[model samples]
Target: MSLTLRIILLIGSLISFYLCVKKIKQAKLKVENSITWMMGSFVLILMSIFDQAVQWLANKLGFMASVNFVFFIIIVFLLIQVFIDNIRLSTLNEKIKNLNHYIALKENSDEREKNVKE
Candidate 1:
């Protein structure tokens, strides 16, 4: 990677890491969710610092350029993060559905009991 790209990545990663922490501290982001962002930022920092390793890996992987490999890594990481988030959303949706059903059943039962009493 070029020096300019390396510097940009390094600064960007640090800023990302800092923002993640700030959000967590401010209670705007959950710690569990921020873990992925923190990890991703750390990986980017490592990659920025170790350009030689990145270049060698890119060559071995048949990438046309080290920057392409970096972009590929970032894209893959984001995809995985999105997939995991979808799984969590699905689970939450199921729980909400179950709760709503339970609430409806309880309300119905209460209404029926009131009618019988009257």
Candidate 2:
């Protein structure tokens, strides 16, 4: 609600957005992964620039403090990010397991052919 806080949030969000872009340029982060960061920074900037929307939403949501609503949004976003990461990790693990199994089977068949030739 305070002007100082708003300025800080705006500056922080801008810095975050800039850094996210830099990472993308450097090929250190994929565009898909950076989407959440970009969106988060954009949301912070939006809430900072449009404080009235935050207040109205907080009122509608029955949150006495707008700050509480902000924190809730941040926590929920982070939780969703964590869930998505878990799903990605699970898929990667499954792919790795399948690859390893295929390699093992291939090696065994190759060994059998070699033995038959010998």
Candidate 3:
């Protein structure tokens, strides 16, 4: 990354990490869910701090530019996060449907029992 870009990323990462901590403290974000954000910001901070090492690795990996490599990593991580969220949402949806169905059945059974008694 260029010097300016590196500085910008470093600042951004630090701010992100700080915000993550604040969110956890406020109980706005759970520890488990904030772990990924914290880790990602740490990685960015490492990259910013060790610019030379990142450049070397990017060169070895055949990336024309270190910025591209950084962006690629960010995109890949985001995709993975999105996939995980999709799975979680699907599971929650299934649970909600099952619960609704069970409630409906219970209501129907109760109505039948009451009518029979009457």
Best by lDDT: 1
Candidate 1 per-residue lDDT over residues 1-118, each given as its tens digit: 9999999999999999999999989999999999999999999999999999999999999999999999999999999999999999999999999999999999999999999999
lDDT of 3 by residue, 7-29 (tens): 99999999999999999999999
Comparison by TM-score, 1 against 2, better one: 1
lDDT of 1 at 84: 99
Ranking of predictions according to lDDT? 1, 2, 3
Model 3 gets an lDDT of 0.93
Q: Which candidate do you rate higher for TM-score, 2 or 3?
A: 3
Q: Tell how far residue 30 is off in model 1, in angstroms.
A: 2.0
Candidate 2 per-residue lDDT, tens place, 1-118, comes to: 7889889989998999999999999999999999999999999999999999999999999998998888888899899999999999999999999999999999999999999999
Q: Considering lDDT, which of the candidate structures 1 and 2 is the better prediction for this target? A: 1
Number of clashes in model 1?
0
TM-score of each: 0.93, 0.92, 0.93
